[model samples]
Each structure stands twice: as structure tokens, then as C-alpha cells.
Target: MITDTNHLTSLREQFAALRAQGLRARDAARKLALSEGDVMAAHAANQMHPDVAEHSLYTTMPLDSDWVNLLQGLENCGPVMALTRNDSVVHEKIGVYRNVSATGLMGLALGPEIDLRLFLSKWHAGFHVVEHTPKGEQHSLQFFDAHGRAVHKVHARPQTDLNALEALVQRHARPEARPVFMPGSPLRPPILADDRIDAPGLREAWSAMNDTHQFFTLLRKFEVDRAQSFRLMEGVHTRRTPLVSVQWLLEAAAGTGLPIMVFAGNEGCLQIHTGAVHRIEVMGPWLNVLDEGFNLHLRHDHVAESWLVTKPTVDGPVTSIELFDEQGQVIAMFFGERKPGKPELPAWRALAHQLAQGPVTVAQTEAA
Candidate 1:
């Protein structure tokens, strides 16, 4: 927060030193106790190093203006990787930006290869970033919310239409200048109550739910956070499951070849994987699903709550394992792949049952 112009030169030098030491902008910021964007802007302001002659890791091209327009321009950039992630998950899909359109702060990209739910209201800042690597130059467009957390990112594949991408960036690039960004406000999550919840009422509402979308309204009506509501309605609508249940869920889906919906989202976007999982890989605490057009990375240890939720639907009982973080934000959700006229797959339900704490009571068995 050295806001003075005189300190800018010194800031860039320090950032450059860190980059020389091989620290990524994000991890460097974590060590320096600053936002990632702040660290990037500092070095980006520096003149191109005379030693390097041109492109360097210090280079960052700030892309400003109508973010939607920037996205639409990408429609011509063929075969790119679209990425959206939050704290616990990283979702990447490879596809062209096709059939893009927007109205107000909402957007849609119902391309056959790529599906996205865009909430443009949170798209406050963006940049076309370049990092020099041994293999060659890596290019990416990264967007951030008001709080400086990454919202969505796009990266070019080896066979992508680079000419089109370059043209788009050139058209929308902010004038030659130093890029600066405000850190904005930190997240202030509410301190919701643990008591006074209408547990029975919530269970009753859960039983009456005919659509999954109604769950949000149900939480609002009960004035409870998702994780808190799970605790309050424990014996009824939700059951506390083993922490290992997540691994079990993925393994079950892979073992049985069940098509399930894997949902990971932040405030701005929700990325989904709606098919059978063929590959499951674990690296340390992170669990990953590596498929052809999809990748899901989840840190199993960050799961503060994992609840097997049963809500009645016209098609029958819909069961989901909803994972939450410490702030009560949903890190991810898993549901059996199903259509309007279909009940949840029997295998999926049975897998969820294996994670349950105790024997299923007669009433619970009758829920579907």
C-alpha cells in the first residue's frame, strides 16, 4: 500500500527480484501479504528490462472496457481452454468461444463444447497476461472480481487461432500505460446463528420441494447458511457423512460408470461436469478428475462440511453430497445425473447410503 509515486520504482525492483527467484505472482503476494494483482501491477509498470530486450515475466497487458465485448471477441479465437475456479476447485474446459452473447450484466455461451453460467456483475477487472517459459511464451486472459480473486480465465492451446486472439487483444487493449488495481473490500461473511432454526419446518419444506432450485429459497426462508442449515436439519433433510465420502463419491461414480453432475463455482460462474468419470487421480490432498474435455481439482482437506441431502422431487428423492468451506460457501456439489422424467440412479443412491452414519430408518427409506 505504498501509494506514493516515488515508491513505485522500488516496488517493481523488489517484485522483479522475487520473479528472478522463481516465485509465482500469486505465491509471492501471499508471502508479501498483498493481492496477486497488486504484485503483478508493480512489475508491469517497470520498463522492459534492457537485459531481456523485450518480453519478460514482468510484462502484463491490462485489458479494460466492456468485459463482455472482450469475451465476444474471443468467439473467433478457436480452440481455447476456458477456466473457472474457486478456493477448492479448478475447472478447465477446452473449446472455442462460440455463440456468445450478453444482456445487461448476464451472459451466455451455450456452445456444444463449452457451457458456462456468467454473472458479469462481478467481473470488475481483467488482464491479458503473458509469462515467459522455457518451452515458449504462455498467454492467458485472467479476470478478477472486485475483491481481487480470480473469476474466470482463458488460455490458448497449441493449435488455437493466435492471430484472432492477438487481433482481439490489440483492439481492446488499454492504452500503453502502467496498470494499477484497487484491492477493494475483503469478504465479510455474516455470523449466522446456530440456534433458533425451525428444524422441523425446514425438513417439512425439504420434503415438499419438487425442484432442486427451490433449495436456495428454502435457505432464505429459514434465514440459515447452507452449512448451518445442514446442521440444524441433520436428522431429517441432511445427514452428516464421512469426510472420506468425497473420495468415495468419485470412486463410486468411476467404478459404476455412473453419470453424475459435478458442480464447482464462485460468485461469478458455475462450471459443471455432467458425464461419467473415467479417470480419478489423487495428488497429495487434492483429488482430481481428468477427463477429455473436463478437469476438476478439489482439496479434500478444505471440506468443512459434507452432507448427504435428500430432497423429494416429482421424479423421486434426489440425493446430493454438498461440500462447504469454513465461510459457509459451497466449494462443490455432487448429484446423480438425471433428467426430468428420471429418478436418481439406484447405484448413486446406494453409494450415498454407504456413507451414512447409521441404518436407514423406515421413514427415511420411504422418502422416495
Candidate 2:
């Protein structure tokens, strides 16, 4: 799903035109080579729950099966160790760490904040404290194993506390004798504006969605940008219009009746459902089949924005740098891997800059 700006732009227009032609969802999907199931899901979800349909379709996916955690009780819970791309953070657990899901991936669930820094690279017997900085737009960190193998990571900010974060990962765990602190982030979502999930709209959309596919479509439509872009993909061209951003994405997901699975990169992506927003679990880089999850890209009319993330290679430094969109769409592929001698400016910042390129001038309007 690596799309250049031109390709994305064309896709948007194509989707809009197809929709205008009153083509069936199947036709448009076929034209786009997208999953007819996905579109049908979106369409059906929209019909059933028009109000919150977008949110649901874009964010939720329930656990396919039961996740049984091996660790139990307060002992399993401890300090939450966080490793972001830029820095690391820690949180102490005031409560029990219920093993929900780690970075949205299922498998191991346990309560307790394990020091990812400790076990990420090598088995250090002594304790150490690592300071994480957020100054230069640094947002995430990855953890490595004793053999210098990268295993865990976290995206910082949204202001997560140690305890709160620890609780999130501690609850879900696999039965391992020694509890190694892993890197994690707290789910501190941003606030939302009124339009994202209108209370009334959520209620309305909830009732409308007849099936899961429809639910996802509506949810997918929650973001003004994503929706518009999606419409553009279906062939709706919202050239330079103010589209939804990540803030809106979260709010819509939270307020809507549907669940969400965030297929994210440097930015974000969500697979919505009728229940809750599920975080897609990252099993690591070698798990390429679903490794990158799903990809989505939006670029300026001209510039090909580079979206970057730390990609893991089978054998190399902790990670390799790669780029993708909110939807996991790889835009630019950087092969040869190297750990930056110095922290290079993150690719997400570049994306932020590119996405911000617009005609909006905040210069001269007099307030009434």
C-alpha cells in the first residue's frame, strides 16, 4: 500500500468519480483493487449507523479468541517501563495491571511495568534509570533483547504516568518465570471537538450498522481527512479542504459505538468496529505479513511526504528506518539499515510539515 502523492491524489479523484457515477460498492472497490468486503463493510456500517458509523468502521475489532494471561495478581504488576523512538518514560502502578493487550498485539498479557531498557538489549543484573527527552519532536522508543535484538518499543507523550502505563501492560501477560519490564505507553488520547462523534450522531449510527463491514466503513469515515481521502479513494476529491486530523480520529473512535483497531505508523490508522477500538499488536518486524499492519497515506498535491518509523530487520541494529502513512502505507522504502549515530529528525515531523502545507492563512481576519 505504498502510495506516492500522485497515486494517492489520483486514487482520491477516482473514488469520488466512481461514487458520483452511482457505482455499486463492489464496482468501486474492484476498480480500486480494494477489498470489496472492506467497502461493503464501510457502506453497510454507514447505512446502519450513519451518525457514528464512521467511527466504528474505522476503529474496532474484538478479540477473535480469548487471551489467557499466564501471570496473575499484584506481583505481576510493577513499574511500567516505556521505550519510545526518541526517549523512554516510566510509570508506577497504583492498581492491578490487567493484561489487556501489548501495543495492540495479542499473545502475552501481564500486569507490571518491566524495564524494557533492562532486557531490550542485554540481561543487566543491576538496575538503571534512563531519561527520555521529548524536546525535538521525538515520540517513540524501541527495546532490544540481550542479544541486541530489538523486541519492544513505545510511543511517548499524550502524557502517560508510570503507574497508569504499568497497569495497561501488567494485566496481560504470558507465563514467564522472570518478569522483565517491557516498554509501553499509556493510552492518553487527545480531546475531541463537537463534530467528530456527535452524541446524537453516535446514537443514530449505532442503530444503523447492520453488520461488521458496515460498522468499519462508517468508522473509517470518522476523520474528515480520512473520510474525505477515502471518498477521494472511492473518487471524492476534496482538494485542499480542511480534513480531519488524528485528534478527530481518536474522539470519534472513543465516542462511537464501534470498536477500533489502530493500524499505525508514524501517524495513525484505525480499523473500527461496533464495540471498542482495538490496538493492532505488533509481533515485530519479521512478522511482515501483518508486520506493518495496514497502510494509509495522504500527501500534499505535489510533495511526496516521507513518513518514517523504526523498522526491525532480521539481523542488524535494533531497527531500520522506514516510512509509511497513517494507514501503514509504505511511501518511501529505505533498505540499508543503520542506527543513526545521532537522532535524526523523525519522518513523522516531515509528514506533519507536509500535511500542514495548505492554503489556510491565519493572517488577517478581523474578529466580528
Compared with the true structure, all predictions reach lDDT values of: 0.76, 0.28
Instruction: State the lDDT of candidate 1 residue by residue for 1-368, as single tens digits.
Output: 35565565566556657867988666666666667766555544334454542544555667775777788888888889888888788888888777777888778776756777788888766777776777787788888776667788899999788889889988877745444556655665674667677777887898899987799899899887778888887888789887767887787677667788887878888766678887898999999999888888899999888899888888899999999877777889898888787899886787677667544333343353
lDDT of 2 by residue, 1-368 (tens): 32244553455456556766877433675677653323322222212334533322121111111222312222333322232121111111122334433333322333332211111113111111112123333222232222222233333333435454345343432212121222233233343443554444443553454432353465445532322222222211111212322222323323331232222211111111112322322232211111121222323121222321222222321211223344323322221212235332233222223333432211211110
Off by over 4 Å in 1: 1-24, 43-55, 99-103, 176-185, 357-368
RMSD of 2: 23.9
TM-score of decoy 2: 0.22
Report clash pairs, candidate 1: none
Candidate 1 residue 151 Cα shift, in angstroms, is: 1.0
lDDT of 2 at 41: 24
Per-residue lDDT, model 2, residue 135, is: 35
Over 4 Å off, model 2: 1-75, 82-96, 99-151, 154-368
